[model samples]
Target chain A: MRLYLAYFKIKFLNEIQYKVAALAGIATQFAWGFMYIMLFTTFINNSDTNAISSSQIVTYIWLQQAFYMLFAFWSVDKDIFDSISSGNLAYELTKPVNLYDIWFIKTLALKVGKTVLRALPIFLICMLPFLGEFTMTAPVSIMAAVWFVITMFFSTILILSYIMIIYILTITAISPLGVKITFSLMGDFFSGGLIPIPLMPDIVQTILKYTPFYYIQNIPYNIYNGYISGNLEIIKIVGIQVFWIVILIALGKLLMKNSMKKVVIQGG
Target chain B: MIELKNITKTYRVRKRSAGMKNAFKTFFKKDYEVIKALDDISFEINEGEMVGYIGPNGAGKSTTIKIMAGILTPDSGQANISGLIPWKQRTKYVKDIGVVFGNRSGLWWDVPVDDSFELLKNIYKIPDDVYKQQKTKLVKLLDIGEIIKIPTRQLSLGQRMRCEIASAFLHKPKIVFLDEPTIGLDAVSKIAVREFIKKINKEDKTTIILTTHDTQDIEALTNRIILIGKGKILLDGKLSDLKKKFSKKYLTVEFNGDIDQLCDGLIFIEKYKGRIIIELNENILTLAKAIAFLTSKIEILDLEVDNTSVDDIVVKLYQEYGI
Candidate 1:
């Protein structure tokens, strides 16, 4: 809708104003990327099971860092959270608009806006060949690159849908802190932000596949690193990503509708 | 046209005492107290009418506004605004109404005020020509043409409030609910806001319901006022009628001779050499009779007559109602 586009533009423009925050975020991502690489190398070097190759690990870590914000499960729009908690939602309700749709677009714009500022620098820096073993490699094939792009787009929406569910959950709770913390911790570990899925034990990866988190960062980054390949297999994974996106969004909308009926703005 | 019948709202709030021990104990048991925010209350407003909604703090003024604005639903009520139920058909009903809360902002804090207006235009689906006309009129009336170019956070409170008023009217809704629109404003800004409100309500035939503790706002803007206290509608009548009911006249006279006793309706407040301040109850003693008595008693050199202000009337009303 045109209204949602306008909201997106306003939210995106608002987000890009924090230039210092973007710079600080880039530095933190680099530090985290290097630390993750260092820890992963020791585990891969000591093992001989060949669960994941060294080159795949390096590329996966770099890609995750480049698009860190896009896939981050803990990154919720604080404005939306505050609106729910502080009774400012009364103003939002006065508008002739659906609360869920506006918030979805706002979260999407915030993630895309922040990722735009930080992703490019990390991508350009990590592509440099002089970094030796730490350098990030390109996609294994042109088809893999295409699949990576497609999956990344779905994954972003997928995660945003999941975040909306958390938002609805927060609305039902007395405080947002508990929901945010519980989801942040659970999503971080399950979405493979804590560790690459291929590097984890086989049974854990099998268990994660049953949940939507397995399809989030795990599928896209692995596809880029050539860990999950072949046309049929990649197509199957993309299909599953679409499936989860539909499911999470439906679940979120249902919850939002139910919660809205009982929603009470406590004080003016 | 707006109407409410038997509207009631009750809020369940968790009860807890102070200190860690009581807090811990209540956390487990979780006792809740139901507060009747709005009792069985009803009122109606005709088109193009400006009504002042006055009450003490926590008197359900905001709750009634929220219910009518579609931000809240009452526990039991039937409210029809423009032939639409506010809570049942919120998305459709809200299209005809606007709301402004004085202490809170509806604008995007980091963006230019124009951007927020643009978004509102899109959200309300206002036609291009209509939006432009509304914007130009509001900007000129509120004197926010230059202020709209700046980001909202950069503007002063007065400037931001002007823009806020402008944004709410950009769509030209049929009704506008203003909760303390003149609060914390300087004299000039307050007058400008009041003038703009009056102009809009008159020109567009837009119904306006204003709630404020500022008696001057009520006195200057609205003729009809609905007074609520303790979740009940205590008084609903014309402002002039309430003024007549609680009216008192203060007469200060500087005279040559004033050594005299007061009448039954006349109470002497202050007496100095050749000067006297008397409280005249207009209900019992007319202003003309009080003046006649005073002139007869002394050769009045100078006289000053003052009426009881709206503030005093409100305090008296509250005390009378024991709220």
Candidate 2:
């Protein structure tokens, strides 16, 4: 655990070197959080809407932006694959450490540290104006906060599993230009990175629930919106999230083992 | 200790024809040609032997190094090092070996060289006392004490190469594989690297397997040479033996004053102010008859002869092997 935190802190210091970029990153998160506020506001004003109350919308947007740190995924593959193909892999391989874990966890720490450091502060800044609006029971608010944290944690695992699968596949495929372009496009529409799914097209909204993306954002978004309700609904969402996490991880392991066979053949 | 028996590796490489149309076609069709990288090669290095692994381009030098380093598995062979199969016991086996690829910089680009060393220490799980002591020794030997505190990105290639060698050795592994370690280095840097390598090999008896196109490196380091060509070990013996086996019938000729005549196998290879020197094959003509002819024809300045250096033999080997 000490080593893990050391790696995290080292990465944090590395990323903090770009102070202006870090500042801009936080500013961007809040600027975009306000856009979602306008969006949900436009939706709530459509009628005396109980589907999503105005305060719940604000809560949902706040969680979506605040705990956004939970869903970030990073992989060691991009660096590892490039180095392997370019003959630089020899250096890392000659070392005494597990090369895979070294890169994998370091990148994970980088993405998580950057996101939390950027996302939480901006989320709090954006939510500061609406603190006067909420008058909820402390226990209920605490439960909601705990559930949102759990949602973020499990969702991150699912997303990381997906990234791991892509990384393993990249060994055989070479040059993950296709994956990079796809992820860049995915960021534009899905994962609440750019826009919330509920306000998207009917087909997109339906697809989001099936994907791990919504758990990363929209599920937590729903929790704060109070759209999630009843003991049974909570059980189902949590159960499904856990199920996907297990399934994704198993699938990632299977691919990783299969890729190990190819690593023997291709020597990547 | 390292043992490799009949190790072989083959790589399937895509073959593309001329024209953008064919290149586009290969994107889908993917034509491939198999290349035999290592062909039934066998060798054993005892614990302390410093051997030079020499070859021409595409001669499987790097492949062999990678296999020994645990980064590659041979297609078919048995290789066991210190009771561990390299590719099978990768993590464990790699801990016992250090590799330096001359072309690549392993140091973090933006971080100080010492930071990279510290990271390496953590990576290898070296005890703090040993790490500090080794770092001090390496810094003193390589003369990179100042540069180690500076970011690697700002260092010159020679300085960075020094750091690279030091980094690989800090762990004090039993075996070190240096692939073209002296490549592109200046004369001073080359001598410094050679001296350091000699020191480590002598002081610690670390098994050093070096691959280089530079014959000077071979002469200065390994007395035993393993020559590979076309993915096969064609010759393995002492460097002097190789030279003796390749050359026969030395030539001696003394030219009177400066008379320029172009003749096959008669080389104007060496010259002095009062004399002209040439090596003529006694197999082609007797040295006594030639000397008699030369002395009778004109005034003889002076002439003596000696065997060619190791460089000429290597060039001849390449020509004969036609790699």
Candidate 3:
């Protein structure tokens, strides 16, 4: 755990060296956050369906956009996979440590830095305009925000396991682009990044329920928007994430062992 | 300790004719061919033996090293290194071996060599005292004290290869695998690397398995040679044995007094006004008889016999095997 924290610190420092890029990320996050807020407001203004009430819709959209990186699993998880597949994995392997823990720490650090530099600032920027229409007195709502962050962290690991499976074979076939493309479209819609699941028709929801994407985004959206208000639902979501974390970590370890069996790096 | 039995490895690669149509055709139904990289290879090295693994290009030298290093599992064979099966107990097995691949770096590109070494130390959890003592020794021996602090990107190829060898030895593993330790090095750098490797192997008894195209590397460092050709162990013997078999013969002669007539089989190869030298095939005429025949006819010059060098032996081996 201490090593992981140190690795996180090192990764953050390395990332901060590119100050302009970091600032640009924060700026981009804010622009996209504000755009989503405006789009949700227009949807409520122009439609009678009232699929989502204006204030609730705006709040959920802000949080969703703020935490876009947390929803990133399939597309973002390949960073580690790519490193491991290219004989570059030796750099990590020669270390007298576990591959999972080291990568796990660095990955969380990247996402956390993104969350801090981009998401936190974007949330702050909306405060000036959102203060007038929203109620800030709900401290229980703050608990939901905390749970959503935890969900995103665990969700990232679950998604990484799937990506690692593709990477293991990437070492064999000599490419990961195909697997990356597979994750992009299906992962985006399934994870509720394209559209909120409950807003989807009944049949789509039934189909998506079987996929892990719902746990990544839709459930978090429910918590953020008061659709899931009870403490019990928060516990269930956290429990699901913990469950996946255990299973996925184990699966990743197994694949790592099997993958090493075939990686011939001597002359290559 | 390392042992390999009947190891075979094949790689399936996609192949296609050059054209957009072929590319499109490959996408739908790829033409794949299995290349037999290693075919029924076997060998064994006792502990503390610094053996050189040599072969012509694409003779499966790297494949053998990779399998022994636990990077690949053979298609059909049993391999045991230090009483551990490599592919099965990978994590534990790898902890005891240090590997350096020439032409590729294991160091982080943007970081200083020390930073990379520090990370490796932490990763291996080496005792600070042990790490410090060994590092100091290697630094002094390789004369890389000033180089280690520089970023890897800034170091020259020779400087970096020294650091690379040191990095691999930090853990003081039972065996060190060097794919091509002296590749692309200047003559001085080559000698320094060879001396450093020789000192370590002599002092610490560190078993080393090295593969290199540099014959001088084999000559200067290791005496035992395992020659592989066409994916099989063709020759396994000492440097002297190999020399006696295929090495060239050289005999130098200096005139005791001025001479004119040269005997047959002894061609006048070099002449420096009043000094005479001759070249002859040792197989066709023995040196003593040639000298005796010359001395009987005329006053003879000083003469010395020298066996062919390992470099010439390697060239002849390559030609004879036709690899």
Candidate 4:
């Protein structure tokens, strides 16, 4: 556990060095947020009656933009891929720590660090006096706020587990780019990043509810908007999130163990 | 404390020819060639022995090192290091060993060297007192006190290599495997690294297994040399013994007058106006007999006898094995 914390600290410090990249990411996400708001507003205006109000939809889009880094599946970590390709894997494998946990902690630190760096600035910019109207509303109740945090915690675990599977694939000599693109597109499409789950057709929403992607961003977003109310519903949603986290983690561990058996550290 | 018996490792490398057509064909149907990386290699090193593992390119030097370091498992072999199988007891076995690859940077590129050391301290679970004591000793020995505060990327190759060696020692591992540690280092840096390696081997009684192409490193550091070629252990014995076995005696004499004549065992290598160089084979003729024969033929003014160096003996071994 202490070793993992060391990995976290080093990776967090490493990610903080890329402040310029984080600033650029915030600008790009803000632009996308505006585009999403306009699209959502037009959809709500054309519909005779909507499940979610226009103000709530606008706030959802803003929140999605702020949490983009946390929910999104980025590329396979190039540092790890390069380490394997450049033969640094030899040194990495010889460490006393478990290889899976080493990468898991590093990946978690990178994601959380970048999210904090970019999301805080985006959140502040949205909360400015002039932009207050576009900002998300506070959670409907204290329960909603508490469930939001709980669901987001589980959501992060699910996403990290998903990324770990891709990393394991990379070590097994399969290119992660193809899997990354497919998974990213599917995750964005179903996780309410491109379109909110409530606005989607009922059939599509039903299908997404069965997929783990729905629990990642959509659940947290819905909780923040007070769409998922009552203690019973929040507990059920948190239960499903925990289930997916465990399943994904088990799959990652199995793949890692099998792949490492035939591990080949190429080059000198 | 380390033993390997009949270790063998084979790598299946994909074979592809150049040209777009061949590339496309290989994408569909690939051909693989099995390369014997380590072929029945066996050796034993007692604790605190500094053994130089030397070989030519593709001679399985890195493969053997990897197997010993627990980075790769041999296909068929029994390897026991510190009474634990490296690959089977990887987590526990690795804690007692440190490895340094010359071409790779084990330290974090963007952080200060000391930060990486701290991380390693945590990774190895070293107590604060032990960590500080080891770090201080390594810093002074490697002369890297100032550079430890700088990021690894900003340091020169020599400085980085020094820091890398120091990082490997921070955990105070019982066994250290160095693969080409002095590669690409300047003469001074090379000597410094050699001296430091000697110091640790002497002071800590740490077993050091070094693989290098530089014969000077072998000459300066290790008394025993294990030469591998073509995935097989070609030679393993005292460095002095190997040198003496392959060493040829060279006799250079400045003669006042010389007659054009040659002996059965002596091969005339070069001849000038008054100077002549001849190689003596000890099996055919003794040095005393050669001198008697040579003096009778010509009036010798000055004579010098020299034996082959370790470098020459290694080159001769490589050529003889056709590796």
TM-score of each: 0.97, 0.85, 0.86, 0.94
10 residues in a row with least lDDT, candidate 2 chain B: B248-257
Over A1-268, each residue of candidate 2 has an lDDT whose tens digit, in order, gives 4445545555655655666876776676567666777777787778664555666666666665555544544323355557646657667767756544565566676567667567657555654544564311121356666776676667666666666666666666657667655764574357766656655677887777787666656676666556675556766888888888778777867775565445532321
Q: How high is the lDDT of residue A77 in model 1? A: 94
What tens-digit string does per-residue lDDT give for candidate 1 at B1-323? 89999999999988888889998897569889999999998999999999999999989999999999998879998998999989888999999899999878899988999999999999999999999999999999999989999999899999999999998899999999998888899999999999999999999999999999999999999999999998999999999998888888898999997467877799989999988899998778888898888778789999999898999999999999998
lDDT digits (tens) for residues A102-205 of candidate 3: 76666666666665666666667665654665421121378877766566566667665554455555655556777666765677778767666656777988
- Write candidate 2's Cα lDDT for B105-207 as tens digits: 8887767888788877777788999999999999999999899989889999999999999989988989999988988999999999999999999998899
Q: Could you say which candidate leads in TM-score? A: 1
Residue runs of model 4 more than 4 Å from their true location after superposition: B251-259, B262-266, B281-306
| Candidate 4 overall lDDT versus native | 0.88
> Can you tell me the CAPRI class of model 4?
medium
- For all the models shown, what interface RMSD does each have? 1.1, 3.7, 2.7, 0.9
DockQ, prediction 4: 0.77
> Could you tell me which residue pairs clash in candidate 3?
A96-B123, A96-B124, B254-B301, B256-B301
* Residue-level lDDT for B253 in candidate 1: 90
Indicate whether candidate 1 or candidate 4 has the larger DockQ.
4
True-structure RMSD, every candidate: 1.5, 4.6, 3.9, 2.3
> lDDT tens digits, residues A142-207, model 1?
998999989998988889999998899998687899999898789989999988888778899899
Best by lDDT: 1
